[model samples]
Target: MRIAIFTDTFLPQINGVARTIGRLADTLTRNNIPCVVITPETKFQGQRNYELLVSPGLSLPFYPECLLSIPNYTETFQKLNSFKPDLIHVATEFSMGICGLKYASTTGLPIVSSYHTNFPQYLSYYKVEIIAMLAWKYLRWFHNMCLKSYCPSKSTLKLLKQQGIKNLEIWGRGVDTELYNPAKFDFSFRKRFGQNKKLLLYVGRLAPEKDIDILMKSFQMLNKKHRNSHLVIVGDGPLRQKLEQSAPPNVTFTGYLHGDELSRAYASSDIFVFPSTTETYGNVVLEAMSSGLPVVAAFSGGVRENLVNRINGLACSPRNVMDMVTAMERLITDETLRKELSLQARDHAMTKSWDTIFNKLILSYQEIVCLHNKVTA
Candidate 1:
């Protein structure tokens, strides 16, 4: 099958959405499926079978790293038409994705999309809740072009459905157990921070929407008792400077780590403390579980689907500092419970296969193609 994906984000971007696109393209190419990526220019350099077409872009004001593309429609559409994709997948609701949507709509080609982020939640964080109604109205209209709008989490699917988006489906992410396993843990690396301290890891963007302040405050509260505990923040964002200033002495911020380094950080950590309540799907939570780390995350969104309190992981009430403090203390004090959850977390992660997830997505694409052919014929 020939597939074209138009998205604003692509590797080597640190976000889950960008990583997922790269993974999806690689998987498709390995399986002998023809796929093309239309994304904004990045400092990305990698080997791949699929084609990557970059468009003109400028950085977003609020989101420094995120770029909005300006594609020459005449040139882009000409190339897409010549490539003659069997189906199109619009992964972002930005410029490039809009161009793809326009092309598919005008040419009567089948289009499928995935809802990866909760922009409405993010708007509230940025204090742009005033434009939220207009945003949702626009989102609903944009996604209506999709043959099926796949959401990364069930909670998100229900959310979009309520927001008047039709044909919503679940398309959850899978973790790489081979890469993020306990066996990859490096004791020597842990010694760099503090050999004796229990590592508390947070691996995601440090921004208002991420609720990193809650994490810092919770860690500070936990630090008075657990003096030997360390907080490691392993991702960068616009709020990095502010977060660094607010963070306690025990906290250490590592800008970003990728590939093996990322896996090592996850495996070496004792507990994964995720305070973000705005996540549509917590990819890092799954990665932590794969690394056999007992996780402490907010009890909401996609994280809830994979985490079971005192089972694979523990979840506190979303954005509740006291609840997070209580849940975290349980794991820190009770060594036996911590180890038990670690084992269960790894086992739970094993069930999430990337191949299985991709195969299902491919099936959905084929179905869309079939339906489109019938309609055209």
Candidate 2:
């Protein structure tokens, strides 16, 4: 069946939602399913196998990396009519997603949505907690119109259900084990970044919502005791300059790395430290696990779904500096514990194959289309 995916984010953006949608497009192509991805025009050119329809957009003030597309209705409608997709997947709750919902309503097409980011939670980080209630109210209205609202983790599903959204389903993420394997480890990469020290890695945007302040504070505390350790922050955002300026010694910021370089960054690191409590599902956490690195992340939001304390990884209290420092210290000092968790992390990641996840998603799409056809007939 043909599918149309509407998202504010896409390839070359280097975020979780964008990366997930890119993989979905690739999977649809591999399965011989004709699909069209509707998104805002980006400056960076990316290679894709599916139809990519771009609309003029402006970058968000707070989050400059993401664009808010102002789609032309006539042009969008003509493209949708020509594509004639059986299903529409709204991957974000922004302008592009609203366009998709409107199209679905106008055409009586089956529509599904995926909840990727926790925007309401993010508002608190940006000091805009006043609009949080309004944000959730809008989200409820948006997702309730869809045939199904897919959440990346049980925790996220529970949150949406509490917010009065219906027909929720779990649509978890998966990693490419072959690419993010321990075999990708390179001593040279470690030497260059870590300076022959134990490398601690944190991958993802350096934004307020990521609780980067907590991460930096925790790393500083951890470094005091173990000066032999180094912290590597991957990915960049609006706070990159401020973070770099205030960062402690031995902390290296590798703006952004993709493909094999990113995989090597994961595999070469000794531990993965994530302090973000706003993730829908920690994609980098799984990627780190796939690379055989023990994780030390906040035990809140969707992160709790994957991180098992003292098992595959250690889950610390959210926003607590000392707690994160203690956890990182444990991993650094105990080689046996670190190695055991690394093995378990890799084994857990091996079970989550991208093919399996995408195939299941396709089945769900087919079911939604079939049910819609019956109702229309």
Give lDDT tens digits, candidate 2, residues 162-214.
99999999999999999999999988998785566989999999899999999
Q: Which residue pairs collide, candidate 1?
A: none
248, model 1: CA deviation in Å? 1.9
Q: How many residue pairs clash per model?
A: 0, 0
Q: What would the per-residue lDDT of candidate 1 be over residues 148-197, giving only the tens digit for each residue? A: 99999888888899999999888889999999999999988799889888
Ten residues in sequence with the least summed lDDT for candidate 1: 58-67
**TM-score for each candidate, following the candidate numbering:** 0.98, 0.98
Count backbone overlaps in model 1: 0
Q: Give candidate 2's whole-model lDDT.
A: 0.92
